[model samples]
Target: MTRLTALLLLLIAIPLAAARPTIDAHLHHVNFLHDSDGLETLLDAMDAADIEAAVVLGLPVTKKWEEDAPREPRYYMGDEAPVYYYSAADPLLIAALDALPAAQQRRLYPFMSGFNPTDLNAVEHVRRMIEAYPNRWQGIGEILTRHDDLTALTDGETARANHPALIAVYRLAAQHDLPVLLHSNLTSKRERSFIYLSELEEALAAAPDTRFIWAHAGTSAEIHRHQGALPKLGETVEQLLKRYPNLYVDLSWTVLEPYLLDQEGRPDPDWVALVSRWPQRFVIGSDVVGRFGNLGNIMHSFEPFLAALPSAVADRVARKNVQALLPGQAAMPLDD
Candidate 1:
């Protein structure tokens, strides 16, 4: 083709490639301090980003603003203060959802994330939240288990995916037909192997009936900050997906740089192939914590990867799969 024709073709393809709608399957409505921009602000962000729906989660842990600190830290990692499990996170989210009308509420799927994953009472807490809200709580998690720095900073016994408490929680999720969105890192910041893989595997095997979305495919920003990337992640994820029929991968921002996108920001061929191989088992998420200003950028960053896949597969990852995992049949009124 001539240079002008190629340029013209590229111009035409850009619009088509960017046209996919999205559902953020792993968004956090409250930050570490249990603060948020409210549901209306999030709705505006979603509209601007072309996001049709979202799985809204609350941070179960909150950072303490110690009196000795120079100034109050707005984020968890701002200081050496220990984080504690904050059960009020759920009520805060519930208040936000209740403030909005039913139509606006449908756009957001709130998951119960306040209880300590290591506490046996966590199972009962999840049950109460679900029963109290009836159809309000769709799933359980963004549950912090085996996280990198966050784990060390949290002021409690470490939460593991396979903890007896979590196994019980997983059973509760299955009973309610709710998908659990879990954040268990595959490996630690220093170790290269899948040290925590078995913990996650145990959880999966313990409650085979429960559906789980492995956040960031078991990776974290802190892990990447230290190790750059997990070795053989695609192969490991594929292996897990093959083994667990209920397993679904959450392709959030942390996986974008080294796993899904190449150095040039183009989609990595291997990931595209894996996603195409099992289209229904994968979904994308913003993973934005308590802030919606960057929501559009976070969602749009996946466009290159989404465009690289077959249209049907791309659509599933971008929008359909997460919707299917949601508990209710509420009408998603996007245009409203």
Candidate 2:
């Protein structure tokens, strides 16, 4: 093609790239042992989706203990039946990133999550890793406290967000200026009600210095009890956001149906206004696990909702908000 033609094509391609640039505040590094794909898959998917940066956390607790348990296809959360677990200290995630050249790693903001929250020494476990690879680690968690179905699947002693052991972990995170991405389901997973949020409120109150990302905006996976329609959680979400300046919201796939969009894939005006009220407090997360077969379309899944938002509000929630939180933001590329 001629230079003039090539330039024209380049100009056209840029707008198709990112209607609004985005930072995936939440995503996972698929462990190749049990998953369909791994780090490279995620990297490629992120690029295709126009996701500029992603916060990748390792699974903190593994299901290795489920080895002797008989598999029951009828069990709840069946896909998560615990067969094997890579420990909280597993080097597999870091190793994969280490294998990549510097340019590739820049697109990823890795966080340390593979630590036992209930262990008294959990604080030390995270600290040692952070110290060992100071530059590699930017945040902590996706810490599973009240997560549905998976709660029983874990081998370690279960603890709530406000448990003493976790309190210590949060303190350690604050000391390092590492933001903690907590996955304490806002309400009871069974009841789908706002009963358990106080546990989160307690944790937030205790760790005033820590920046906490409330994954799924406290929403959990849908269960049989959801009764066809879920509660409108926008007001509850606003209350929490209003109460905690240190808190940020992760609007992951778990909340796509009830919290942000409707059955027709359109944005809810109330939800949009709630998010727009504090656009900086919210960020988009693909919430993909161990698979990138569809990651490219995950962030774009929110396009209709984003389109409904004011451009400035949409861009902030999509990209700039999370960018402000990243530790190595200065080194990341700003180009399409």
Candidate 3:
């Protein structure tokens, strides 16, 4: 090749190589609790996807659904079917972490949650885990919100009640300098119900030091269908994101089809505009439930979303923003 052509090709390649981001902060390595070799599969997927690091989470088995028969204590006591419940200290999690490649191990940060948040002594439990593996685990949340049985553990007042114990957990997170990932959602005919934006504002005021992340952007499938109703909710979320330096949101579950497109099948500019405004406050999360079908779908879906954004903005939303929230950690390449 001519010298001029070679130089031009090199320049283009350099910019393209430097553009890829380096982290996915909202990964869930739950198979560690069940599959003996789950961490291998998790790491393989990361490597395949060119993901540099991921924030892992552990939860009791209550989140799992039984297909054929009863095996363990059912946490969803209502009309919902029985599902097994396990402790956060389940051996699988520790084993998976132990088995990971040292580089991949450095990339994994753990968080703790349970179906019955109140019964688990969340504060004490997370404190112990963080104390034991200070570098391996970083924060806690993804706490269940809808099930009545689990909600009862938080005193039957809904996840937003800020019950004494829940407050204590938040306080503990603050003391540890860790961010709390909340699973608050916007559901109901009214603009707010399960966990209102107002309630979150109050919580932030009460615990200014505690970093907060609204899992799923606080948007649900049902809420997304009523696009007209979201302006108020969006306004509230926008206000919170602007008002609190510690407040953040996750884009993991927020990209449901309805929210991404209108009835006519066109991209919704309003939604895109809202997300773009606070790119720094959002993080990439698959919320991968470990089921093969779910994992495959999430893996396929995120690419288009990434492709839609400007490279600089996507870099922050995909990884850099999360790295900033994680205290004491320098930003790393998403695909390193």
Candidate 4:
């Protein structure tokens, strides 16, 4: 190749190679069966995806495998067996995090997620977990409240964002300055409006001090599956962000489909504008639920939408925003 051509190619490759690394704000270390591919698998996936860090969560509940069942269920929804609260999830997560080397540990921000949100003792459970682990847990959840099918499938009283038990948990979270990742859907199947939004709003109002990451921005794959795309979701999210300073949106699986990207795979202008306006309040997560094989693809799927955003705003949503949510960690510039 000519010297001029080689020089041009080098200049182009430099920027691409140095592209900012992302922090996956949401990731699960185990599935409903409490199964995992281990921390090593996750680390390799992170390296491949150029992800600098991750907010790793544990599944709060477990799916029951019936002995009479024809085959073992791989997922929570794969069988009719009822799911129930499993407190051991947190310890497993603690064990995994503890097993990692200091460098690998630093890359993972472990959030405790194994308690019944309806039990008043849930507060004590969270407090005890924190006290027991002492400087181990970074945040509180991926708390499964108001989840569509999971709400019905879970073998207990329905879990809601405004549940009394969760209120106490929120207070504890506020006291520790820990962010809570909550999965509360805004609507149910066949509802034309955000029927369940009030439940979330009530919780937000009650815990003004706690940082609540609204998982999937109140969207869910099941809801979309039944009702198709939700209209004006962007506007609703914008309004919520305006109303609550402590509220943050989790841009994950379900929100990506119709809200962030159009059917043609183009970035939606409304979402771009909304996220650009409040970049600091938004963060991206894979929501990959204990799987790492496709982690790279899932993280990179946001590229088009992130690319559509202003460079600064895109950087915040991709990495800095989530890091800043951690207790003492500051969002350092990409160059640093």
Candidate 5:
């Protein structure tokens, strides 16, 4: 091979190799039954896809379906029958992550969950887990509230972000300097209205110190299931970001599909501007629940939308911003 040809190839490879990882900030490692995937498999998938890191959390709520509710949720990926209620406990995640080798452990950051959010003691429960895995625990949540079918199936009062019990939990998060990832759907399947957004805004005001990762930007599959009139969330999100400096939006697949993309599958220029305007306030998430088969593709889906953004802004939304939110010890180094 000629020296000139090889030199040209090296120059092209250098920039590609140094590109940042597309972090999946909202993936689920555990659901009702248990931690379904092994850590090594997940890491290998990330490596193949060039995902530098991900925020791994167990679903805190176990769903209990009504007798009439179908055994398998229509959109669920796992082969098992749909869980009527998500099993409650953090042990699955804790035990799963604890068993990982030191090097593999560095690829994923663990977030505490597996507790009832409405319990006044939710904060203490999460705190105990944090203390148990000092270097392991980085954040708390995927806290399910006003969830679509889950809320419908739940027998008791569904927890809201503004609820005093959750308020207490936020206080605990603040004390520990940990970020709280909240999944409070803006509306229920039944109502199809923006009734619950006030609840979220109130909570954001109450705990000014707590950094929140708002999952799905209030979009959920249940929202689609009922197929009722919806609020213009894009405008609402812009306002919320302006109002709450502590809040970060998780642009998972739910939003990535219709909201962030145009009918033609192009990145909505408006979204590009919103992200670029507040580069540090937005992060991308795969929203994969207890499944990693498509992990790489899920993270990769955001690339086209990201490509529409400016270079530096694209890098921040892709990985760096979310890494900043992770605890110093648990956050991974950037590819650059």
Candidate 6:
């Protein structure tokens, strides 16, 4: 072809490539012993959906028993199964991904987890993971922040005093310029205040450059109970967003039946307005785990919520926003 024809073809192709939707920034891939195919299934779904990339988090479930304890935690044996926990850096995670083709590997981004942020070793572990796979991984998170755990941190009488370990991890994140995704939730039954907000604010203040992505929008309590009052939680989120430029929220695990139980059986407009104002500060996530039954239900529940969103706004929340946060990674196609 002549130079003129080549130039014309190049110009035409650029627009077509720019039209594709980028990727889903937050996707959970469970690698239970018996279910080795979970990651493959998730990748297939991403391909079918035209999702260019996905951040695959490793969540290992295990059982823990107190030292020399006569009886194990009673809750484990009941209707709710008890499983011990593991971090994202477990060897099994690398092993699982090693089997995939290089192209698929490039499409997946992994993040290390230190379930207990208070552990000193957790800090070192995360730092090493970032150093080892500087490009393949983007951040450290999916850190568990249970009510009991926070209570123990603040409790003077408890054996486990405030460790300052999470703070240390944040420091490392700040130094490395990586975002830290926290799993914070409302602890108390009362509606007056959220317990961990103060601690989180302090951490952000200490590490100004360190970004924090709050999973589930810092929602600890059931959403149904707060139905018409969804806006009530806005005050906290609004304050944090304004105060911390690096702070972000994820719209995941928000579509469960209990969380969507308003009189209209729809999400509150107040909540929508809050997010709309700062669409760049949020990302779409499925939080899918377990077999087809669980994954199917989660997908079913989230589709409508996503569809209900305004097209332009949804596009930003679903993909664009996340790409902006991680510039080193590939950017999403604008046209799509």
Per-residue C-alpha lDDT of model 6 across residues 1-336, encoded as one tens digit per residue:
522233324434342222335455556565332233466776776654456676666653344444655765333232232344455434556666777898888777666663455566667877677666665556666665643433332312221112377778878876776677676664433444555567667766777777777777666434323432334466677788999987888766552233332333466565667777776777766565433223323333344344556776668776677766663543344445
Query: How close is every model to the real structure, measured as TM-score?
Result: 0.92, 0.85, 0.74, 0.92, 0.84, 0.72
- lDDT: the better of candidates 3 and 6: 3
- Compared with the true structure, all predictions reach lDDT values of 0.86, 0.72, 0.59, 0.86, 0.74, 0.57
Model 4, residue pairs in steric clash: none
Candidate 4 positional error at 269, Å: 0.5
Model 5 C-alpha lDDT per residue in residues 1-336, reported as the tens digit of each score: 422233324434343333357888988885454546777677777887788888988776554334665564433333333433233456677677778887777778788776676778776777777776675678888887878666554445777889888898888888787888999989877675688999999999999988899998888865855763255677889899999988999988777766676655678887888887877788888877676776766666676689898888888789888888875524333334
lDDT of 4: 0.86
Stretches of model 5 off by over 4 angstroms after superposition = 1-20, 63-88, 190-192, 228-231, 328-336
lDDT tens digits, residues 1-336, model 4? 522233324434343224457899999989889899999899998987789999999999999989998899898888788899999999989888888899899999999999999998999999999989988888999999878888888998899999999999998998998999999998887797998999999999999989999999998888887888888888999899999999999998678886887766679898999998887899998888777987766677777789999888888899889988988765455444
- Tens digit of lDDT per residue, candidate 3, span 15-94? 22233444655666654224322666776666655566777776554434446535532334433453444555434456
lDDT (tens digit, per residue) of candidate 2 on 206-241: 999888989988776554235433565778888888
* Candidate 1 lDDT (Cα, 0 to 1): 0.86
Predictions ranked by lDDT, top down?
4, 1, 5, 2, 3, 6
User: What ordering of candidates by TM-score runs from best to worst?
Assistant: 4, 1, 2, 5, 3, 6
Clash counts for all predictions: 0, 2, 7, 0, 9, 5
Residue pairs clashing, model 5: 62-85, 62-86, 62-87, 63-84, 63-85, 63-86, 64-84, 64-85, 65-84
TM-score for predicted model 3 compared with the true structure: 0.74
Instruction: State the displacement of the C-alpha of residue 310, model 3, in Å, after optimal TM-score superposition.
Output: 3.1
Instruction: Supply candidate 3's per-residue lDDT for 82.
Output: 38
Model 4, stretches more than 4 Å misplaced? 1-20, 329-336
